[model samples]
Target: MIIGIVKEIKSSEYRVAATPGAVTELVRNGHEVIVEHDAGTGSGFTDEMYEAAGAIVADEAERVWTSVDMIYKVKEIFPEEFKYLREGLIIFTYIHSNAHLDQTKALMESKCISIAYEDISDDKGQWPLLSPMSELAGKGGFLAALHFSQTINGGTGKLLANVCGVETPVITIIGCGNAGLGACELAAAFGNRVNVLDINHDAMMDAKKRLPQNVTFMFSNRENLVECMKTSDVIINCVLWPKTRKDHLIYREDLKLMKKGAMIIDVACDEGGAIETCRSTTHTDPIYFVDGVMHYCVDNIPSAFAQTASATLSNATLPFALAIANKGVKQALKDDKHLRRGLTTFDGKLTLLETAKKLNLPYTSADEIVSTF
Candidate 1:
């Protein structure tokens, strides 16, 4: 099987889907790896490195896309890439079908096998492919707050860290998942008072054991949320909002409850999902003001740390990619039930229930499609 690696073309997206080490692994397995020229440049891997790993270096993305059996990527397929979609082509990537209706349509119309990394579940019910990037996004979200909080960056000029002879800053984190824990770890390490709120008692208790004494765990109720808004210097939201839910956790009017100059860092930048005011932003123009409250909702926060993000993401996704390559998409989906959960589209049918319900499209179960194979 031939695996293609293409450079990410999304705005401010520097992370590559595969590193030379990952290519080496594919080559070692007797699979032909085709890497587009400069595909890994943003992640600090040169073309020579890919060549050293026994991958064919194509001068153009078209060559890699056309020649490979499967296209391994980091971001969703853009409109420009939509023309490349064809029957039986396998796209293994972070295909957020529920968010991008047009891309989902293209995938279905093209009859391609599209697997979403974000939807893939492990035996523990955790998103293994999405976890690495989520952790990085959480840590990077806090760093963004630290940078934007400075007066020079047009922020409130309030320092996010604790200072001598001054009151300590408060950082409020919503949810106790991987992203929230990552943000809490950084916030508490800076000696700032950190409050982690979640409805899950088990999750909160687990977070409490790992976090510092300065960190407080609270129930995620309306009262606690309002209180956090009024007191916290920074609020980091890590909840993954459902695509079908129309209501928001933080409404547009709720921004008024926050302190003046306070900022919100939404690690899960689901537009109109969790936060009513959140619209996806790019790193080039990451922040905006809504009712005088600053919002930092860059959709791809991990892209800011391309090298680390690429390495970690590649490590998590390589095994699954290898499985599909070696066993073929049908056999692999049939064998691994967890991997089948990621199947968004197969043979021109929408196989993901969430995406079908969100987009009002026809639904086909992955199990049903795999059984037919």
Candidate 2:
């Protein structure tokens, strides 16, 4: 199989989907690897590194996209790349089909075999591909809060960490999943009062066992959430909102309950999903003021720490990518139930039920489609 690794073109997105080590592994497996020139430069990888790993370096992204059997990317396909979609090319990436309606249409119309890394699950029901990036995003989100809370950034001048002769600022984190735990670990380590809220008792208990005394576990509910908003200096939302759900966890009216200058770092930057006011921001303009409260909702927070994020993400996705490369797309999907779960589109059909329901389009099961082929 010929696999192509293209440089990320999204604004301020620096993480490349593939690394030199990852390419080396692919080459070792007898798979031809093509990398766009400077694809890994943003992540501190030079073109010579990829060449040393036995990857063919293409001068233009078009050569990598047009000549490869499969495209490995970090983000969803953009409008410019939509023209590259063909009948049989496989796209293995974080194709958030529910969020991008036009991309979904492009995949279906082009009959591409597309797999969404975010939707892939392990036996324990955890998103393996999405977990590494989510963890980084969570930690980065807290860092963003710390930076934005400084007086220079138009914040309240209260540091997130405990200071001598100064009161410790409170930080409330919603959801105790991978992202929330990441945020909690950082926030609590800084000697701040960290409150982690989750409706799942088992999850909260699990977090409590790992976290220090500075962190408090709270049940997520309207009353508790409201109280956190009123008292906490920073609120970090880590909940992965459902694509089909119209309701928001934090409504527009809830902003008034928060302290003035308190910022919200939405690790789960689902537009109009978890937070009513959250629209995907870029690293260029990461913050916006809404009702006197600051919002840090960069869609790709992990991109800010490209080198670490790329390596971790590459490690997570490599096994699955190798599976597809070795066994072919259809055979791999048919063999691995977890991999099949990640299928967004197969042979021009909409295989992701969530995207279909969100868009009110017709749905086809990946299993059903793969079986026929």
lDDT of every model, 2 decimals: 0.93, 0.94
Taking all chains together, the TM-score of candidate 2 against the true structure is 0.99
Evaluated against the true structure, the overall lDDT of model 2 is 0.94
The parts of candidate 1 lying over 4 Å away from their true place are none
Off by over 4 Å in 2: none
TM-score of each: 0.99, 0.99
What is the C-alpha lDDT profile of model 2 across 1-373, one tens digit per residue? 9999999889999999988999999999999999999999999999999999999999999999999999999999999999999999999999999989899999999999999999999999899999999899999999999998999987888999989898899999999998999999999999999999998999999889999999988899999999999999999999988888899889999999998878899999999888999988999999998888899999999999999999999999999999999999989999999999999998889999999998888999988887886
Report the lDDT tens digits of candidate 1 across residue range 1-373.
9999998899999999888999999999999999999999998999999999999999999999999999999999999999999999999999999989999999999999999999999999899999899999999999999999999999878888889999899999998898999899999999999999998999999888888899999999999999999998999999988889999889999898988888999999999888999989999999998989899999999999999999999999999999999899999999999999999998899999998998899999999998899
